[model samples]
Target: MSNQLVAEMGVVFIEDSEHHFFNARLAVNGKPFTSLLTPRRIRDFLERNNIVYRCHKGKKQVNEEKQMEINRAVARHLGCLKRPFQDGSPDPEHQYNMDESHFVIDLDDGNPLDFVGAQSVKYRSIVSDRSSGHNNVRAAKGGSNARILCPMLIFKNKKSSYPILNLPDTVYGVYYRSSPSAFINGRLMTEWLQEPRCWGHAWPFTAARTLWMENASGHCESEVEDTARELRTTVRLFPANATEKVQPADRFPIQRIKEHWRRLAERRNIEAIRKGDWKTGSASSGKLANPGKQLFLNLASECIKLENEEKDHNSVDWAKKSMIQ
Candidate 1:
């Protein structure tokens, strides 16, 4: 019966697969196969069939029509699809994009260093009852120019239980803020725009600047728009459900940052274990300290270092070409 069910499922997956398998109305022999599908069993079946699940292929949201509409709207807003860039090209230095991404200190990407042909490998990290810290990162990049604005980092307010001692005002082109929700809102948006660490440095480049952002409630607030206009900045909101295609930050840098952050966190965990800082038998159950502002600062610093290195290499190559000319 199970074999028959699996065959039916395979057919369903091939013929009329939903983006999410769980959303599909799966059945066996004309009856709903409501048994919980365990990962182990799924893996077993796939191994038997010599089917390999490609981890690199990411799943997208099932909103094709909505995404298409969003793409059209973004093109219209950017004055690109119907118009030529030469007619009204925005200054590279004045064009910026910002977005937020979250990070969980205890969550690893599940990449295990297991021996070949092992059934499974498991690693553990300190689990907490409270939610993982939120990292509201904003990646601001300009057009043709290679300049990148400092990324912003926001975390939940430090409580006595999760103490962060002697936090610095700024760390290596990244600004840190502690908020109740660790999310960007209209008020926080206004403050970030006005802050010297962010748009303040770009003031000399252009009198009027444009910022591209998603249609989040915080970015869409009327007050936020009013504030940007007052600051001689124009905030362009990306069309609903279209950020994946249109937002430059979402395209690359944000993912890189998250990847680097996870690596740094893993290294930190390993080091803690080596130093005996994490007591496996302790009452706390050997969970490492709640990753605080400083850890994020280090992650941001590493990202900046890598970006600068790449930019410098590109600059050198350009300079060599100029000399040849």
Candidate 2:
């Protein structure tokens, strides 16, 4: 059949689907319809039947023109931010941005892995009786400078307070707290903003200093603004609906750093399992223990040390690109 005819047929199928046709069995066959029981099933069914469609990689997407507008606005915002440094202090020691990278438990699924070059894959594999039905997580948020501040670690607990982190004198201290869901909330946001190192040290672009952050609900709390004001800092909200484009901490730094985190976590997780060290099991639970906290601080300190020594990559514009791209 010609491609045009197939495309027209595909439109007809879509119209039928809108009317709940996919949910009904075929009139011609009282026997089971081979597949496609819901609107969402249409894509996979069409693919199996040798049909094609253009698909964007992520579920969430914006119109091309809209994204272009967002990019241009971000470029302009970045240009204005650079003006403060242009007067020749050179290093933007006063400007900074921060964001959170949350890691979740993907520990065990019933799925089995096969040897890379094996001729025949075996079916028998270990499956636990206590299989998990839901995933849990904890998040870490950190600020950036030539030296990254100690990551503010959130631990999971239903308590009002957590054990004080006895930070090693060599690196910046880590702030930790507990929450039921382990996600950062208004309380944590307020606490983080209150930290002197967060904004107190940075020189302002205007009469009032503002810290740029994405429009997260927690970050927009009245208390957060109040706390920032108390610290003599202003809270700068990122453009609504523009994520990585306007979020200084969400894009490039995360992309590269997350890759490093994965490599380090994966190797340690596997080695720990072999030696019966259960601390490597969960990203937050076992890993946020005293030893685990030490692990994170040390690893981060090492990376920061290297960043400090690498003069070639430390140009003012490059630093801006690295943190906020």
RMSD of each: 14.8, 17.0
Strongest candidate by lDDT = 1
Query: Taking the tens digit of each residue's C-alpha lDDT, what string does model 1 give over 105-144?
Result: 5543333223445565344454321455666656465544
Question: RMSD of model 2, in Å?
Answer: 17.0
Clashes of each: 0, 0
User: What global local distance difference test value does model 1 have?
Assistant: 0.58
Q: Best-fitting candidate, measured by TM-score? A: 1
lDDT of 2 by residue, 1-325 (tens): 1232233334445434545555334433564342324345554555566544322245677889988888887777778767864775433444445566554323222222333334453332121111111111111222244334445655555563556346343445444555665667788888776654433444223344445676678778888888777766656666666766666545445454544544454444444434445433434343312224445544444443333333334564323455533
| CA lDDT, candidate 2, residue 145 | 42
| Model 1 clashing residue pairs (backbone) | none
Please report, as a residue range, the 10-residue window in candidate 2 with the lowest summed lDDT. Answer: 127-136
TM-score (all chains, Cα) for each model: 0.65, 0.52
